[model samples]
Target: MNQAGMISTSVSTTTMISGSHLFNISGHSITKELPAGKCIMSSPFVVGGYQWAIMYYPNGLNSYDQPGIAFTLELQSEGSGVEARLEFCLVDSHGRPSDIHKASSFCEFGYVSCNRGFSGFITHEELEESWYLRNDSFVVKCTVGILDSSVVEASGCGTPGNANDTHQAEHLPPSDLHEQLRKLLESGEGADVEFNVDGQIFSAHRCILAARSPVFHAQFFGPIGEKNFHNIEVEDMEAVVFKVLLQYLYTDVLPDLNEFGSIQIKETSASAIMAQHLLAAADRYSIERLKMICEEKLLGTISIDTVATTLALAEQHGCGRLNEACIEFLSRGGNLKEVMDTDGFGHLMLSCPSMFNLILANINDPNVLRDLVIRFSKTSIKS
Candidate 1:
């Protein structure tokens, strides 16, 4: 035997061909076409320098290890072409032979060249070329591309979902105090009345005269109620007092310091004196313009007696500004002594003795103490 050229009996023992092929060559008759269409190709075919594995139907009823084989045989051809395609058929351990379907008749062969050691197949399309196939498995290969680059650029600028919808208003300059007050006083009359005072307009509704003083009512209602006062009447003394009261009411602007000529200094009297109660009432009702007017008037006409009354009212109603002003006025030297010596000083003093002490502690003049002692002695004699 030519040992090198001979087919060894040992090799034939391991690689045996049986079943239908053997029967057909032996001239034996067999029924059926060997169930050809039901047969599938089995794995491991070599072409070029690469080994091709069998492809499986995605919906085939088989496990990953038990593939229903069908694969393309790819090869580099010598002078035949750049590439060639081949097809195959297989048989299982049973006598079932694979149906010999069409071969490479419908397939298109193509060549791919890649850098040595790079180890991957490249396709014409960029997206497809970025995939690696090895041993029948496909994996994504990381590569820079337009999609990732664009996303990185956008992220560098900002996050995807942040836009503000709210906008703030611009600041305005301060207004003229007296001009604003004048305008407020001039605005009209009635239950539902609108008036402009100190740069703001005030609106009041369902209001009535709680006291019969035309001047007092005028200040309370502004020009609107002032106009209505033409139809109202009062006796001489009441009308005079009401006129002074009305002046205090209209502007929260008080009369000159000289106007308190002969009036008594009591809670109602002091409130009536400067009309601060009216301003306070306006503040209580949320009439901003009126409250400003009242505040302005209180600042202009602040006095020892009025401060005493206002301090008490301010403390009761939590009016911090008014309370501060009262403290400031009493802190001045002459005012506290004057308040303690006035006709109803004892009554006023009794209502706010702490305020008196606060005044005494703050007064800078030594004479203020002497005056307070003399005034208390006179009050005791009268009582």
Candidate 2:
């Protein structure tokens, strides 16, 4: 695609000149006198394979007090095989040719040719190439490619990517997060498993397992033993938990979970039950691994009533965050009214009256309060 276009800039000056003496002597001509402060000149040229219009203005004079000229050149190149080149000369008030000098370094030159595409060259190079006048700033352009196949060949093809492929490859499917999690979870157990994290892999089972959990325990204790086992004042809790959980997977007998419960049968013992509940809660909330470790710790300490009591206690201790979780389990729709009416109610209210209030406020009828008091009184007397 051979297309041509032109860019033009205008210069203004405080230096004044009579209209008649400001004679332009290029193949182009001044078309119009602008307002009191300006004049307009146009150049006939081609750029990027099409004809373009150019213009110039006056600045303060050289040492001769003549009108110093500035210029704006615009070129538009379109269509194939378009080219132009032209020169400009200036005549001073004395009717003699003025001495020409190169313009400042900040002056810029750019050209767009049909075959060469768009390019910028130094103004000095532009002036030298076209034999432009240096006495005053002038824009010189001419139809350049008309006679020379060499210039066209030298310009090269303007369209890009002619020699290289431009198509992109299709995207592939994403890696699975579950698979990654499973791999990480199974890497090692407490005190023996080795794994890498953040580019550092420690061979010690204790260190690697510790990365998974706050509790650390030996691997032989089985999965249940691994629950609830946390290192005392551990340097890093996450590392400890990670290692403990890993160990639980490898050996179902978790020493930490075992430590909390009796050595006999590992069935649903108090500690084992508690551990299971904690594990279930943790898993339910998507922190299953952490829950496992906690369950292991509380293995012998959990029961339905105990969980309810803990809910109240957790609330009283300002562990309201845990209280919400505890309440979720306790609100499973049972004869909770009778349970609450016992002496346990006094303890419950004493521990967490706010939680009691929350429960009371949710009940449908206020008349139940008297029955509740009577029941509480009877349970208290019996206790």
Candidate 3:
């Protein structure tokens, strides 16, 4: 067994292999300030084929335990008799990992017992004086090495079956093909076609563009579609949005939205307006995965200010998941009336009038429903 900086174990006679589980303690610096608890815990995180959690006691576990904080590493993984070697650390804020507390000896643990590292690992006085606690967050890094019996059975660490894929993914860097195609797209090398969105021109390789998008495939090659020997003028899209759409087509990624100067969505607004436009672009192009990604981003951005317009956008693009997310968010009783007061609310009400029933049913006051009904009736009569 190796201890000082490495942990290892062989549960069976065949071979020995190891994997690491990093249990990061984020948002835990304030746990020390909270009063009167012997055991406070970090949220459970899954890694290395196990579920693990961090337990910290503000008060010492007992009279002999240190007055500061203590830590416990728990293995919540299923199945028994599995062997694991563990190391624990209190990561330093000073950027020097050597300045922090780490266990010198690797300890073995399972569901039967937890390895409580050195008690009074750092006294309350010692830590309070240290920079380890910053911005009410500190990290406790735990590395667990699990013994794999399959290694011995295979004669060596040679990956068997689908693990070959996993091993390849782990060892291989990003494929050169991805970078080459990205460079080709950026350099406009061998670009066979162009799309002019309003006045801006986007040059693309026909084969690559067609390979990535069915819409592009159809427009460039399929029956009943036009052949673009020259620049095809694109309509109903901003040039900036089209560039990103084409970028996704080339690279299967959305460049960090922060890098784009044209995106108007701010941090507070949940950044949906650009996603909405992207969603429409994706829908227009009939790109399912891109549409789903845009829908997911839009779903996260839904709130009182954006839900109405988002719902309408979802409806326009036929994003059922996003459409449902918007209606469901508004249906929650927390603040429907206030949301209805926004300008987008009338647009959604007029567009998705049937949803008003669900909104009326879920809101606290029924009078709102009556008033809207009366308003709609009067508008109908006048029309």
Q: What is candidate 2's lDDT per residue for 44-108, written digit by digit as tens?
A: 54333345443443321122322334343344444433322333333323343212321212122
lDDT per residue as tens, model 3, 1-383: 43344322222343334443344444555556655346766667655566766666665566566567676766665646656566666665433332235664455554533544555666655454344555556666665566655533332233234344444566677777756777888999888898898799889888887787888889889897776547799998888889888888888878765455575444345246777778888888888898888887876777788888888887777776576556555544445666766778777767767666655644444665666577556544554
- How many Å off is the CA of 262 in candidate 3? 2.4
**Model 1 TM-score on a 0 to 1 scale:** 0.28
Cα miss at 134, model 2 (Å)?
Answer: 90
User: For residues 163-196, what per-residue lDDT tens digits would candidate 1 score against the true structure?
Assistant: 2111111234455664554444444434344433
Candidate 3 RMSD computed on C-alpha atoms after optimal superposition onto the true structure: 14.3
lDDT of 3 at 258: 44
Q: lDDT score, residue 242, model 1?
A: 40
Name the lDDT value of residue 231 in candidate 1. Answer: 30
- Find the candidate with the highest TM-score and give its number: 3
Instruction: For residue 224, give model 3's deviation from the true position in Å.
Output: 2.0
Model 3: clashing residue pairs? Answer: 15-152
Q: Candidate 3 regions off by >4 Å?
A: 1-173, 261-270, 374-383
Ranking by TM-score: 3, 1, 2
